[model samples]
Target: MHVEEVFVKARFFRALVVAVSALASSAGFAGEVQVAVAANFTAPVQAIAADFEKDTGNKVVASFGATGQFYAQIKNGAPFEVFLAADDSTPAKLETEGMTVRGSRFTYATGALALWSAKDGYVDSNGDVLKKNEFTHLAIANPKTAPYGLAATQALDKLGLAQAVAPKIVEGQNISQAQQFIATGNAELGFVALSQIYKNGKITSGSAWIVPASLHEPIKQDAVILNKGKDNPVAKQFIDYLKGPKAAAVIKSYGYQL
Candidate 1:
C-alpha cells in the first residue's frame, strides 16, 4: 500500500512538471511578433527587424505587399500584429476606424523614387532620359494600389513627361514586382523605390536620379500597432523599437529618409 501511494504521487508530480514546461514553451513562442510591411520598405524593414530581434530577444516575421492589399487583409482578419504602410493615409484610416491602437501611429520614413535600369550606363542622372524615349518599356508599380506608383505618376506629371512616358509604362502590382521587371530585363528601365537601388550603403549597378520631394507629394511611411496586436507585449515593444536609434540607423542605411 505504501509503495503504491508513493508511485501515484511520483506520477502526479511528473505530470505537473510536464505541464509547467509546456506553459513555459508556449510563453516563449508567444513572444514573437508578426508584421505586415509595405513592399517598398521591405529592405529597410528587414534590416530593422534584425536589429529589433537582437535588442529585444523577440522574433519578428514581416510580410511585404502593397499597403492597399494589407489594409484589406487586416479588415478581413489577418493575423498580423503590426502594419508598416507606404503612406500615412491608410494608417490614418485604420486609426479612424478603430482598427489600430489609438495614437500608436507615426511616420517611420520618407521614401524616395528613382528611375533605375539594370544595364550599366543606361540611366542618365539629369532626368532627361525619359525625354529621349530611348527605352521601349518602363516599369512602375500599380498607381491605384501602390503609393510609390502614385508618387511616380505625380513626378512625371510635374515634369511634364506623363503623356510622353505613358505608352512605355509597364505596371507591376507592387514596388518589388516593378523592381523585378527592371532587374530581370523585362523592362528597360523602371521607377523603383530608392531603397532597392541603394544597396549596402551605395547605389548598386544603376544610374538613378533620386526624384526631388518637391516634384510630388511626400511619400511618408507610417507604422501602427493593429488591433490584433493590442494584447501582444512583443508587438508593442517592436513598434516602439522602430522609433529608436538602432532601427533608425538601419532605415537610413537603406537610403530611407527618416
Candidate 2:
C-alpha cells in the first residue's frame, strides 16, 4: 500500500525471476541431444537415456554403430552432439583432430568380451568349444572398426585358433549385427560384448565364456561432447547423467564396468 513497500516488493520479484532464469539455463535444459553411441552399449545406453528424459525433460536421439564409423562421421561434421565410443582411442583421436570440445573426454565404461552362442550349452564356460572345432560358422564384428571385434581377434590369436577359424568367420559391420548373426543362427557362435548377453548380474540365456580381461586390451569406453554440442545444455547434462548413480547402475546391470 505504501510507495516504499511497493518498490521493495517489485525489486524482490525481479531478482527472483533472474535467479530462476539462470537456474533454468544451467540445469533446466530443454532440447533434444543427438548422440552417437557404440553398438555394444546399445541396451544400457537406451535405458540411461530413458531415465535422463524422465528426470530432466531432455530428449536424446541416439545412433548406434561402430566407434570407428562414428569417429569418421564426426570428423566429417556430422550433427551428433555427443559421442559414446566403444574405445577411448577413437574419442582421443577426435579430440586430437579438434572434432570435439577440448577437455571434454572421460571414460564412461569398461567393456568385456564374450564368446557367445544363441543355443543353450553351445558355448562352454572355459570356451573349449573353440578348441573342439564343432561349429561351421563364427561371427565377429569388423576388427578395424569395432573394439569388441579387435578384442575377439586377440582372444582367437591367444588361443592359437585364428588361422584355423579364419575361413568360417562372418564379419558384421558392427557388434549389434554380429549379435544378430549368432542370435538368428546364421553363425553357431560369435564374439560379442559381455553386456550384450548379460542381464541382471548374470547370463540371461544361452552360454558365454566371458573372455579374460588379460587376453586382450582393456576396452575403456569414453564419452565426449562434440564441437556441435559445446553450447548444448542438454548434451552436457546427458554426459553428466551417464556418470551419475542411476545410469551407472543400469550400465553395471548390463555387465559393463564403470
Q: Who wins the lDDT comparison?
A: 2
- Runs with alpha carbons beyond 4 Å of true place in candidate 2: 1-29
lDDT digits (tens) for residues 22-96 of candidate 1? 999976675788899999888788887887777767889999999998999999999999999999999999999
Q: Which ranges of candidate 1 are over 4 A from the true structure?
A: 1-30
**Cα TM-score per model:** 0.89, 0.88
Local error of candidate 1 at residue 72 (angstroms): 1.3
Q: lDDT, candidate 1, residue 128? A: 81
Score each candidate by Cα lDDT.
0.90, 0.93
